[model samples]
Target: MADPPPAPWIGSVAPESVLWPGVRGTQQAAEWHNAPIDFWFLPKYAHLPHPVVPDENIGGMLTQLSATLRQRLDAVPPTPPPRRTRPGERQDNSRLKTYRTRLRPNTQQMEALRKTAGIVRWTYNRAVEYLKAHPNASFHDVREHSVTEDGLPLMNLSWVTPVLYSIREQAFFDAHTALRNGLADVRAGEIPNFELKFRKKRALFSSFRIRTRDWDGGCLKIPNFSLGPGQHQTKIQTGIDVPSLEHDGACIKQENGSWFLLWQKDMGEEKMRVPAARGPEMCAIDPGVRTFATIYDPLRGTAAKFGDGDHKRLFRLDTHLDELISGSTQASAKKKCYRMRRAANRLRARIRHLVDELHWKLRSYLKQSFDTVLLPKFNAHQMSRRGQRRIGRKTVRAMMTWAHGRFRSRLNEAMEVV
Candidate 1:
């Protein structure tokens, strides 16, 4: 291969961005994070080839650069991070909630994600194994030994060492936290044993969490998720066309045969003046199989049914999937199994689309029309079980397939702060 593109960046500029005063353009209609930062270079800095760096914080970077150029042009030093409130004074926090959607990644991107996740899993497993040998070892001890020169063979992290060093640090930090918490629990007699939870590849430990403070434009650059100091942006992260909202971090997972990026998005909306609470003109929702919702307004003494939201579509999609599976068996399956995984993936997409549409419709309608919405708590597992004394196996099967819990969650998400 030709010599790798020269490292476009020299060193992390002091206080981050120093070339902002020259930004003449913002964004081109292009792929989200991979696009170059279009800036107007000053005459003095014209010799520099493509000063644009691979960071998603272009807006914030430019803002900083503008300030830096102002200072330099006026013969003064650059400024630092934004001013904070009275030294130790605290700011009041409002009720915040996270709304998240699955991230869609291409084949190449999915493989890269899988590789990164593998690194975390391997490191975690290796660290646990080493700690077992030296039961008295502390977090610091295990961390130091795992990545050091002499400890090379102990974990063999040559592949992911440099490219994913920060991510590894994050993984170890999480492991340390778990160990510390377990130790504390043992001392306090909270549980009988202090065995730390092992990280598994495909179970409750399937997800790999990441909180990136760096400027790699992949996923962390989305709105409130970016830890860098700058004005919060409203742009989408990578290729996902999601609404702009704040989230703490993202957890990466491979579900079925695809990757998912899960994060909590704040669901609050700008306040529109309400013409009073309307004195408890309340509404109650009763869920049903034939109809998705039955709304009862006691004040008006009226009852109305909302048709089985997406259940029909879900059932239709399920039928299509069954047909696909049955046909796949006829495709030269003597040598090897020939089920079309791609068709199965399409069925999954159909289910996903239906669920999304249902959630959006329910949330918007309830918020816009009702004053007080009362949703009954449900146990879907118990509801789905057809005990020996029970009837309607088909009903139980339908109940199991439908997303009752997700519907309840959407209703809860719609509730405003009291």
Candidate 2:
């Protein structure tokens, strides 16, 4: 029977089947992580050979391709650089939220991210130096910064290091490529500045690894990277719509410090078709100090208020703890304050969860009572300013910390017609 189907190729076999001889059974069966490998077509490189094409040929094509891209960008208009805004003048909540997220990264990850940032900065400076020296020549005519390997120009870098072989390398290359293109545009008088100043700030870890087959067409194996020893591995497969230099997935940390690769499959927007309808029904949301949210339903002619007394109590306790922390001289007292602070954070998370549930209930009521919902575009910052004048500044700031914008966004997303 064709030599028993060549001992049932484990890699090719369905994850559900019983483990065959010489095949290792994974900790989990048939997860999204252990799915089959697939390829996506890159629109920009559709006419060119596949990524799996021979290294020498790929290098030659990429060199010519880079030149063509540089020329095209030179013809296009460059975008104007962003202007620096005063600290108080920046009103965008999205920007503020992004700033808040930056505070979440640990020390180690933050350090790594900073190193990459430095690399980018160095690359930009070098590129500028090159451009300045050769003012007469076009950027398209400029050669790449070459590195030597074994006394020869390192054209084929894929074999040298796994990091070089990764999608992260591609992303680094693409970022520099785009910057070069932008510079070219500026040089041609297509737009304003030849340089865009990137602000130094914390950035998320964008690149991660996943297990895949070897470069020499060998059996499937893990790539050379440090994962915790004896850790169960999960492979996640994701789809790509737009061309990307990074894998569309993540390696999630488990309780035992093990990581499972979470592949982001189907990276495309779900086409949402909303049926034609009249204007949304009027629903007044009053966010106040007494209550978290007060819903005035016009359809039912009723007002419902949701309060978080427990959260308020926790907040008060935290305030007392803070006072104790400030006054205390002993180390143990400071430790006690830290514990209280941790408890306060947990309580805050719970309060947020409760708020989300309340919003969900309000949405359900709206769906049943009316065809649509109408809410006043409440500017939390403006409201906070008003509150500061009326109430105390500390009280207004506390209210702002509750994230009224986030609450409003959640409501909009839940109630929006799609």
Best by TM-score: 1
Q: Provide the overall lDDT of each model, using Cα atoms, as 2-decimal numbers.
A: 0.52, 0.39
Show where candidate 1 strays beyond 4 Å: 1-96, 101-111, 131-136, 147-150, 154-157, 173-206, 215-249, 264-277, 298-303, 309-353, 385-391, 416-418
Candidate 2 lDDT, 1-418, residue by residue in tens: 2333533333433552232211255332321111132211000101111113236764565456445544543454455465433222333222121100111224443343334334434434444455456544433333344212332235434433333233233323333455666777787898897653432222222233222211112111223332112244222222322122122222222211111223322222232211212333344455665455555443333444454332364356446555644544344664665554455445555555555555555556555655444354556676567524556755665575456677666554444422
**Alpha-carbon TM-score of each model against the true structure:** 0.54, 0.39
Residue range 266-359, candidate 1, lDDT tens digits: 3343532232234344556766655566565533434444543435556667778877777767667633333364566567676766665655
Candidate 2 residue 96 Cα shift, in angstroms, is: 22
Q: Which pairs of residues collide in model 1?
A: 20-65, 24-40, 98-264, 98-265, 99-265
Top candidate, metric lDDT:
1
C-alpha lDDT of candidate 2 relative to the true structure:
0.39
Candidate 2 TM-score, true structure as reference? 0.39
TM-score of predicted structure 1:
0.54
Q: What is the lDDT of residue 377 in candidate 1?
A: 55
How displaced is residue 184 in candidate 1, in Å? 9.3
